[model samples]
Target: MISQKAKYALRAMFALAEATDDTPLRIADIAEAKAIPRKFLEQILLELKRQGLIVSRRGKMGGYQLLRSADDITFGEVLRVVDGPLAPLPCLSKTAYHRCEDCQDEASCHIRRVFANVAEATRDVLDRTSIAEAIASGQTEAMLDAQ
Candidate 1:
């Protein structure tokens, strides 16, 4: 399951991507526009900035913006940043793989095999979908409108 933090991060990224200008967006504005809690969003934005997904400006115009184009940022990357590795199980994780303690032989572990396939399918979709494509696909618009 996607954590609430990751969900908020995606919403904030969508709001930023949909902005008409390159100017940074104030935290309050993003929180309000996306209907995310301001305090929670502050923490989410900080984590995203630390991951190099976003950059911040200091001063009167100080705010946050994507470090790269929205098209360059994939849903996989965002989810990984906010939710840790995407793998549903430790044995199947690419970034943080660890053999399951109960598994005597990973090569023939039925549980591992099933979940590995599941993880790969999920990754396939998430990695191929970018923030820009997500917005252009109307999902984001529908979500915002529904709120």
Candidate 2:
């Protein structure tokens, strides 16, 4: 299962992606817009900001915005930022790797091969999906309209 962290990140990004050409909006606005819990959204946004995905403002009319254009930010990239490795098996992971403790053989492990393929397919799909596409596809929840 992808972490709640990743889900919140995606939801928040969608909110930001759909924003007008005006200024950024507060975390509260994002949470309310996406129907995410306010505190949870704050923590997720902070991590995303730290990852350089979203930029945050401080003080009076403070808020957050995407650091890069929506098209430039892929779903896979956001997933990586929030979920770390996409692979179920450590050996199949791109960012974090560790051999399976029970598997002694690497050359003829069909299980690993199967998982690796799954990981590859997963990566391909998410990599192709961008925040811009998410918005352009009009794939938002009813919460978006509510906000």
Question: Which prediction has the highest lDDT against the true structure?
Answer: 1
How close to the true structure is residue 77 of candidate 2, measured as C-alpha lDDT? 94
Query: Local error of candidate 1 at 6, Å?
Result: 0.7
Who wins the TM-score comparison? 1
lDDT of 2 by residue, 1-147 (tens): 666667778989998988897588898888888888998888888888999999987888779989999999998999898878889798888888888899989779999988888999999988998889877887645423443
Per-residue CA lDDT of model 1 for 74-114, tens digit only, reads 99999999999999999899999997888899899888889
Candidate 1 segments whose C-alpha is farther than 4 A from its true place: 141-147
TM-score of candidate 2 relative to the true fold? 0.91
lDDT for each candidate structure: 0.91, 0.85
